[model samples]
Target chain A: MKNYSNLNLMNFLTPGPSQLYFTVEDHIKKALKENICAISHRSKAFQQIVVHTISQIRQLMNIPEDYYIVFTASATEIWERIIQNLSIENSYHLVNGSFSKKFYDFSVSLKRKASKYEVALGQGFELADLPIPEQVELLCLTQNETSSGVSMPLSDIYELRKKFPNAIIAVDMVSSAPYPDLDFSQIDTAFFSVQKCFGLPAGLGVWIFNERCVEKSLALEKAGISTGTYHSISSLIKNIKNNETPETPNMLGIYLLGKVCEDMNRRTIQAIRTEISYKAGLMYYALRESKNFEIFVKEEKFRSKTVIVADVLQTPASTLINHLKEHQITVGSGYGAGKDKQIRIANFPTHSKETFELLADLLIKA
Target chain B: MKNYSNLNLMNFLTPGPSQLYFTVEDHIKKALKENICAISHRSKAFQQIVVHTISQIRQLMNIPEDYYIVFTASATEIWERIIQNLSIENSYHLVNGSFSKKFYDFSVSLKRKASKYEVALGQGFELADLPIPEQVELLCLTQNETSSGVSMPLSDIYELRKKFPNAIIAVDMVSSAPYPDLDFSQIDTAFFSVQKCFGLPAGLGVWIFNERCVEKSLALEKAGISTGTYHSISSLIKNIKNNETPETPNMLGIYLLGKVCEDMNRRTIQAIRTEISYKAGLMYYALRESKNFEIFVKEEKFRSKTVIVADVLQTPASTLINHLKEHQITVGSGYGAGKDKQIRIANFPTHSKETFELLADLLIKA
Candidate 1:
């Protein structure tokens, strides 16, 4: 009964699956014209596309040579795979929002000993005096909490990596990837869906994992523990070396992702990061000046640059959402139970600086 | 090296990821223009798209009301899931080709007691001779083997179902669905990738199963057997009931699949089926009349009405493949060891009648 028409025409500013990368439409059109969608995963032409894409992502992300970049259906799949492949006895999670909590739930569901240090919504996690369990095989951390607009700073992540040297540190960069200049030496694994910072269509998830993660997966798999098939680390690794996937993957999605990544590489990752930070600054500044609205995350350092949330006072969050929607800009209502109180806006690379200024003006009026 | 160029522009007549349904480009354009690619999976619009697509598929494929249709990343994933969710100790497979054999391999990979009734490549299974083990919890059958173009006729599938009444039956209709008049009451589970007969892009797998399969999955999950999360049969059933997926699915793929299904429904599934059978007839006739090529499948009943494979003699299969490539008609080289000896041409709904005739002429000349 939410009275909203013209939803299909609205430009999405919601956290994930927001506005597509500016070059996406053109890439898709070119793909169709080139019959890229019709190519077989086993075909030489497809293998070349795979090579080109992986190379583009590696260069753009500055990934180490030993790290393997793999494709999965979604970041959610990566959560399940990480647990299945890397952990056997126990796993730990830094749960600040729903997404991080789900990784913990996955371990529990898979009959593993799962532990977590959970924070309330709109709160941040502190590593000091945190109860991280002993012999915890995998530690899951969310770099950016899309639901609450809270992020764990890279320095804290690096510190945790130092503390848990024995544990495989996996980062969920679902909403913030290229924005985070992650040190592969500190992180064992990381994953992100294309809909987020890459601004491609949903369906593809890029899993960046180092040799350490692969070795653990292989060891577990060798011991007759089921790490699943077709997408097992060994299987994915075996196929990806030949420029193939263990299964017939999302050919069009992969092509679009590569093209978008190529476009980003040409623009230089530094330029993209600069735009994202600039846009995020504008959003936070507007929120600070709005007398009726308060920033959701209490600490300035914990506020996410990619997913920005604000708590509204006099006007309902839905009212602000609708006000923006009228201008063909659709912001997110609060996630989970706080839906009516907070508005979330994504400051993705696809979101231009000029558009952010206009959105800021509209938010101030609201 | 295969010495092929301009591959991206060639029209694919190979099996999966073949020519897209004629309306695909239009649907994609509309999707991009309407901001369909940007919508959140949680949005009501997306759920409606799911509802419409599922309904369209149900109507077009004649899926029964009691059966549930779910999405997976690929048919290979479905093969893994069918083994994971349904089977506990033992599973049976009727393997006639590489795809079918892989399903059996999955059961073995997952630490199950797996047995199979395997036939040679380009061969079909006979029920009378199958050494089906007792206490088998699940049965895997590939309705249409894309690798070898060998089809298990519906009558045989029904007979197998009758023989294995206690076991859950799973059919891999990866390359030939909508064209097959499947009797849902006779089978427990069936799956296909949209890239195949539905003529969408790669990445989306449509899995259809009955209440019996659901019961097994739920019982296994309840007993802490780890049927999987997010896409477990129970989770899929739960989310799909609300017209949603357990994870952020391929929204673009699902949207385009729905539009393609809608188009097929408008043309009528009956007409589509009639056209497929007719075109398949033309392909077989062309193979029979060709002096240098022979139909790979020995038995007439075993021949596929979708993927058509031919054994090239005198001239190498690669030569015929290149000849077709010259005419911009891309056919699949044989699967596995037969790659240089056989050629495969797909007969899908997306392939036009006139194009088939032209292909037939060119193939004859080759």
Candidate 2:
């Protein structure tokens, strides 16, 4: 591996905690000047922050009015909450990679009857033949699998919603939020951590759930099942109604997230998504033309636009990763089983067009 | 209310989320420059950060060799984790104020047989007369009740330990960590949020547990009981053994915390505690000499040195708070029922001696 003694100038291309937005430093400085981190969570000023944040997120994501936005520590916490609050006995998960598999394991850890339809790694799901159990109260779908660089298309998500109409459809948009243009009216819930697409620090998770999920949580509570404690859906709703959180939250993260969402809104989500497609195309083209690399996902439509995974053909994955690292550019090694044979590159909004062009130049030369 | 548009130059005195340490800005800037927030959680670099942070905390707090440090979203989450992992059916809580009461409620929410010994808002526990149920597996104690500005003395903690030898003693030091100077060997577990005395931004919690707590958690898991999902004690321990987290944690917070703890180590925890005492003395003297104010905790021995609460004698609490706000200094209102009747002032390490002297001068004339 290359020594990173001068890594202060490096740019990140890792998946999830990808890159910090150019605006984050200034917003964080403003947060310090305003004493945003010092004020009480119960203060009127904080309530305004929370209200404005939720409103900006709703506007940016085009979230429905019936949907409620709640905060968690991370998206992983949301997985456990879904199992605890939304399902009493059984839940079905469509797992294609590490993160989705972890969600499935969370359900099983909670002693719930968790059944999964898992495909081979680096493969996307075809919802047409998925079996829906009548006893499964919740169906989990990972819209974008970060580990394998495979994503279930938005149309597939809508199809799953139509087929499992009675089940609460929870989408893991941990790495794909604010870009997927997901319809909130169709899915019961979706969650994303801010570190990914939002280009903020890693601390806060946004959980958007409709009234049906809340009703399920309430029903579970009424039946004397333990949904959760402070972060239970009922507790979160009660606090959010008053524009408050049950505990002292990551105030700085929330402030920066709101500011970033406002920035994204000003830039227009459609424009951001368009740029993402262009950058992803640049990355995929470079990989296809490179003599030493190939795209991991077999189907073109299933390949992720955000996190791009590539298989090393003529050299170890580390050689290419270290070559980039030597230039103060950082991307992720393939996750889990693909650690040595694959490399995952992030195509986030923060990775500007110029940076992708530079990376493409490097890839093509190799 | 005073318009705080010009408040950027002021200091904060609110209990917790109260004040940012002077060093935080430069540390955060360095974090950004180093791309600390964007690194993969599974990387060797991130693992080194976690190991260094835990080491610094252990050094600063004089943590025993057998103790293990873990991270959470906030200290409030630790309350739920304690009930889930350590206790099977019964737990005992000593509730004096809102935060402690909330912990008791968390146990009840999980459908555990939770029993609490309640006291008036500002009163401390008298362990001598408290009865311990033989069936209780966990004993919940709050060292510093942030809501009421009352604290259980360190002596009381030791006394309770001797009396309930078989029970796991869980202490909530949310607002008084690294200041309480508790002997960890006597307690099974203790927790605090970094936004408090650590003087960092909110988003991360520090949970310190001994080997016995781990054993209990594993025992519960082995007995076919659901301890928790991802953040269960067993899961946390499993990950910590690898110097990693069960999920993607607040990476920036962990980095900043390690930096702050190193700074604290340089200043020495003893010196920090000494200054906290001096500032508390200054604030208490101001309240005692003033004709309109008095300390809220009736017992001097039980008064918290970190968070000082004062009853407004001839004016509403907001009057004094607004007076300070006009000068661009922020203080906390009395919590819950005391909201309008009292003022809570923080005597954290970040609040300098000169600021306290200035506020003292103003209070003496009021």
Using lDDT as the measure, the top candidate is 2
Every model's DockQ? 0.59, 0.63
For A1-366, candidate 1 gives per-residue lDDT tens digits of 122235556778888888898899998988888888887889888888888889999988889988999999999999999999999788998888989989899998888999998888888877786899767799999999889999999999899888889999999999988898878778999999999888888999999999998999989987889888888999999999999999999999888888888899999999999999999999999888878689999999899999999898965788878778778898888888778998889989988888899999987766
Once model 1 is optimally superposed onto the true structure by TM-score, how far is the C-alpha of residue A313 displaced, in angstroms? 1.3
**Runs in model 2 lying further than 4 Å from the true structure:** A1-5, B1-5
lDDT by residue (tens digit), candidate 1, B37-119: 78889888888888889899999989999899889899889988898899988898888889999999999888889998888
- Native contacts kept (model 1): 0.70
Candidate 1: TM-score, chain B only: 0.97
Highest DockQ: give the candidate number.
2
Q: Which segments of model 1 are wrong by more than 4 Å?
A: A1-9, B1-9
Q: Candidate 2 residues A254-357, lDDT tens each?
A: 88889999999999999999999999999999999888888999999899999999998866789889998876678889898798999999888788999899
Go through the candidates in order and give the C-alpha RMSD of each one to the true structure. 1.9, 1.7
